[model samples]
Target: MASTSSGGTVELSGFFADLVRCETRLYNALNDRLRERHGIVTSQFEALRYLRDHPGSRVADLAAEFAIGIGATSKTIDRLEKQGWAARQPNPADRRSSLLALTDNGTQLVGAAEKTFTAEVAELIGGTLDSSSATAAAQALSKLRSVLERNQIGTPTG
Candidate 1:
């Protein structure tokens, strides 16, 4: 690991590269496992889990939380609806937007998938890093995420 020094600050190019690569690899692994076991990909599992936790959320809310576009989120929701895992209800508060909720099938599937997700995370991440190192890494990443979110950095503008 090499760090380049600019003035008095250290450039984190390697750190950024590692972060992106690690995220991609981890996501792929999780997606593969979830698809194999639950017949749903990681994104679907995440959306279902979110709907389970926050019933009556709108599609826009899911898009915002996932940092994706509305079109993409709507597509995912469409697939879920077709699979009978989720449904959209008319929003009395807003005629234009509908609220989302997980169906009974979705609830059962997500509950089972949650166990697999937890075990995989434990095997992959927990097995790789020690307790203290994992804690420190999570804390650092959380702080960085907070700063970026607070500043709205890298958010899509239209």
Candidate 2:
């Protein structure tokens, strides 16, 4: 247990702490591997993968989906553009927002990286947790995410 500044004690086994620690560890491993093999970090790979799946999505759309700021999303897009992995086109519906798309190079890179990503996840997660445990954890996390999203927690207007 840890004492909070507010004179309360927090359980060390809290789900939030565990979730964050797990996420950090997983993210760092994925980031390192992706950067080593794909020449892009995990964030870039994720953005590219999303763009591949949701072609012509706007920066704001990406920002909302990733729960990040528009400025940060734009910077990521800018980096992708610089690397010739992504491009922006004028949006037909919204003049102020540009549609984002992955380039052919990005498409190929992400496809390859997806394989690596899957393998790493399987090796890291599958190696530790059994199938049933993994499924349960995923389901629980999904439920939590739904609840948070539904409540507008951490949302821009929350």
Name the top lDDT candidate: 1
TM-score of each: 0.92, 0.90
Judging by TM-score against the true structure, name the best candidate. Answer: 1
Q: What is the C-alpha RMSD of each candidate to the true structure, in Å?
A: 2.9, 4.9
Off by over 4 Å in 2: 1-13
lDDT of 2 by residue, 1-158 (tens): 55464637767568578889999999999999998888888999899999999988999888888888888999999999999999999999989889999899989999999999999999999999999999988997899889988887887641
True-structure RMSD for candidate 2: 4.9
* Candidate 1 least-lDDT 10 residues: 1-10
